[model samples]
Target: MSRNELVRICRSNSIESYLQDSKDVQYCSRDKPLIQFFKLNTNAAIDGDTDGLGGIIRDSSGKEFAAFSVKLPAEAIHVLEMKAILLGARLAAEKGLTYTLLESDSLTAVNVISEVWTCPWKAIPVLADIRDALFCLNNWKLSHVWREANTAADFLSKPTCCIKRVDIPVVDLPIDLLDIIVADSNGTIYPRL
Candidate 1:
């Protein structure tokens, strides 16, 4: 089925309906390509006067592809988290990724984007932009992860970290986050409260 048809079906019925209907479609064939996976996190300083947003994208084999971080003007933590998700989606779109799975450590942010929870007034615009970005993709998923499992993004999102506003290709992982990245790639689980 064409991507537009799939999107139309998803909008008319539901994701489950579209999946069930498209089981025999060519795009959903056995040789389907691997989906891109990305982890996103955001942090606000002690005074909530400055926020940092970060995200890391990886291929199916767990190899990092791209990473990005940006400092934003003062905002609520939830707003910052939502902004991080928006940035991730925009970056994926810019890179022309057709399929992606975005992970965020903030359950609230994930829920808001998935429409499982209502978005705050301050975050509606950002959430709308994220939705638009997702709609442009052939396939995408958004889910929540434990902060422990998302340490690389968490570290990048630290207010004190010296990350540029532009997206960075992950050719050489930052020395500071090498250990955490290795642990994540090795499937080392960390306890989360």
Candidate 2:
């Protein structure tokens, strides 16, 4: 976004889209988490007739600790997003990670998880599970970010073959996702031209 447009959005206290143009989005890298905290970026997307969820957990230095790509039955986007977060939180807890900063491109999911908005009926069950998973953590925070900053997770959110769920560490990540991870750690920003 341009300086003037950003200023306008700040003044208005509302954001519709952070677009330089309808056909384009300014790309960027994901921010690293605070020292001693892990960052888990999650995304939910629809591919063809199926729903998919993706998440990546990174250490404070931006090294990937774990990542997941799973397929789910078609559902509302908010529900799918909450499921992705829930799955991530469980993975982090299983790895004994104490501090976490969970991020998602879905503002609706963040707002719901943070209780900034009432939980919608469709998302209640999964959101409750998410709370349970997060409760096991020593400390955690929920945040919303632009989709551009969540490129890896977004790319990984495409549905794979049936029952072909992937949950693995950085070294085992697919080549495409590994490329994004490398770019993110190197502070390389892609311009969506």
Candidate 3:
């Protein structure tokens, strides 16, 4: 098929439809996979104090793709939020994914990410970077989810463990929070390679 046809098919297909079809393909490549696999399902949440931003990224298959929590001074919550969004976007781009839908528990943050209104001064540059990153992907969206539904991101955002990249089995509680459990159980916390 022609490239135009491929683009049309991608543009017309939804994430669920694409994932259903991916199973039949032998080896998926980046060429059209981002259009297919990149669901852009994101959720970000901040506490009342706004000291940190927590979020998640899932591909089309509903898999736990990426999770992050970034900490900031209470005074710099807005700026840090933009940075967090940008960081998420950058990670998505590096992974050759597109068509992301960013979600935030904070309506204010959602608006800023979506450009529904002006971002605060300290946030403008980071917001600009997020816009540029999404533009490169050719598709992105932002929405808000309730806090309860955003637990995955919230867990990731907690101030506990050091940051590293690897596939981790889902845990009921975040590792940082689990430290308390470990201490009580008198078990050592081991790092996994």
Candidate 4:
């Protein structure tokens, strides 16, 4: 098929439709004991030099257990996304969780980490670290999640006035993110452009 035809076909069908057509792919497993759903978001700074990376980890029951936000020296969104995944994996390993399901809003980052696509040169080291961390787990899976489903992570990623350059551990879900977390647990659908 031509490139234009391929693009048109993809745009016409929803992701759910494509997944339903394929039998080999599975997004989640109900039997896993410690599923960690992680979402990463990156924001470019005003100077366009640094990027804010944010990630949140939730358990199988959709409760926000831990989260982190950091500022990277570089500004590439893909790189930041990879770093976020690395951080999430490291956190899971530290917590001694054997089974993890890491999800990200950036499909490109997920594809690279899952070996569905080639890893970019700039993100090689970050991907390596992520891979090493994944080895510590008995089983781990990475998948793409819609941005709307990842609102808490997206909100955590943006630069805040009080947050310094250091990574912050989120002990409690922010007031602003409470509603989004509830919606996500309820499986509320938000259309993505």
Candidate 5:
């Protein structure tokens, strides 16, 4: 199928409706000649609370290909969430991806990103950057997700400073905080997701 035809189909149909049999479709690598899609997730840790974000890029298969996270002070989490979106956009552009989805768990953040929240502040600059980067892509979508469904990115934002340092390069944070986050993450029993 031609690129324009595929894009038209994507715009008209749900991703699952387009690609029901993912096993039959060819999966492209970073080096292969293929259309690239990007998904990015981010979370910011402020004080004792956290704000999570999740972004997805539905290419032919509609799976997440690239994602990331960011942690910051609770009071500054909103600013950091905007920054994460900017960073995710930059990453997508760097990969030469033409389709992108930017998602966040914070409704406020998503609103600002989607231009539903009109007040502009410190985030105006980066949000503008995200806006500009988004224009470069042929297709894009921004969405909000509940924190429970976005675990891998949440894991990346765990409070590291509070954790005790082990031989590993990264320190594990306080057990109590870890327990709470782990429990919040889908209630799954995986030691680590």
Candidate 6:
């Protein structure tokens, strides 16, 4: 083959490889945390005029420990995402949990908290508070998960568009939420799209 043709083929292959590596995730599952740690997953959303923040904490066995949902004036969804995480961390601390695994469906918020991406100015205050809350934990790790695996938290934080049932205790959780919890505990895998 001619030198120029070989160079062109190599560049095409390089571009294809880059695209493959950057491909969006195709599946997600809610993995249980380490034996001694609790996993907290949180999600947030903005309705026309209201923002809903929610989070759920589950033990290594995937049993629910605590969950919360709060409503407030509408803020950017990105900011609300951080607020949800902050609330989750605080809840774990309140429950005297030392080791924790925090998860969020907002990849942007998770990237910011992990310092993998730049922080938007509006979210800085909430991010600062999140850092403080995380600092209280003796051991912790934070990462992003796909929304499908975050079904329970997503249901909890959806805007006023949907009526979220009562608080998320094992007995009081809405049937739908309970079903999601059970699926997660059973290690059901969810498709990304």
| Full-model lDDT for every candidate | 0.67, 0.79, 0.52, 0.62, 0.52, 0.81
Candidate 4: Cα lDDT at 86: 81
Query: Arrange candidates by lDDT, highest first: which order?
Result: 6, 2, 1, 4, 3, 5
lDDT of 3 at 9: 44
In model 5, the Cα lDDT at residue 83 comes to: 70
Could you give candidate 1's per-residue lDDT for residues 5-110 as a string of tens digits? Answer: 5555445323544455554533221011264444333332323666778777766656666777777777888888888888788878888877787777788888
Q: State candidate 5's TM-score.
A: 0.53
C-alpha RMSD of each candidate structure in angstroms: 13.4, 6.8, 14.8, 8.9, 12.9, 9.7
> How far in Å is the alpha carbon of 145 misplaced in model 4?
1.5
Query: For candidate 3, what is the total of clashing residue pairs?
Result: 2
Locate the minimum summed-lDDT window of 10 residues in model 4: 25-34
**Decoy 2 TM-score against native:** 0.80
Worst 10 residues of 5 by lDDT: 25-34
What TM-scores do the predictions have? 0.74, 0.80, 0.58, 0.70, 0.53, 0.81
For model 5, the stretches where C-alpha displacement exceeds 4 angstroms are 1-37, 47-64, 69-75, 161-193
TM-score of 4: 0.70
Q: What shift in Å separates residue 120 of candidate 5 from its native position after superposition?
A: 4.1
Clashes of 4: 0
Give lDDT tens digits, candidate 2, residues 8-93.
54343233343434445454557887888999989999876889998888887778878888887788888898898998899889
Ten contiguous residues with the weakest lDDT in model 2: 10-19
Instruction: Give residue 82's lDDT in candidate 3 (0 to 100).
Output: 62
Superposed on all Cα atoms, model 1 deviates from the true structure by an RMSD in Å of 13.4
Candidate 3 vs 6: which has more lDDT: 6
* Residue 152, candidate 3: C-alpha displacement in angstroms: 0.8
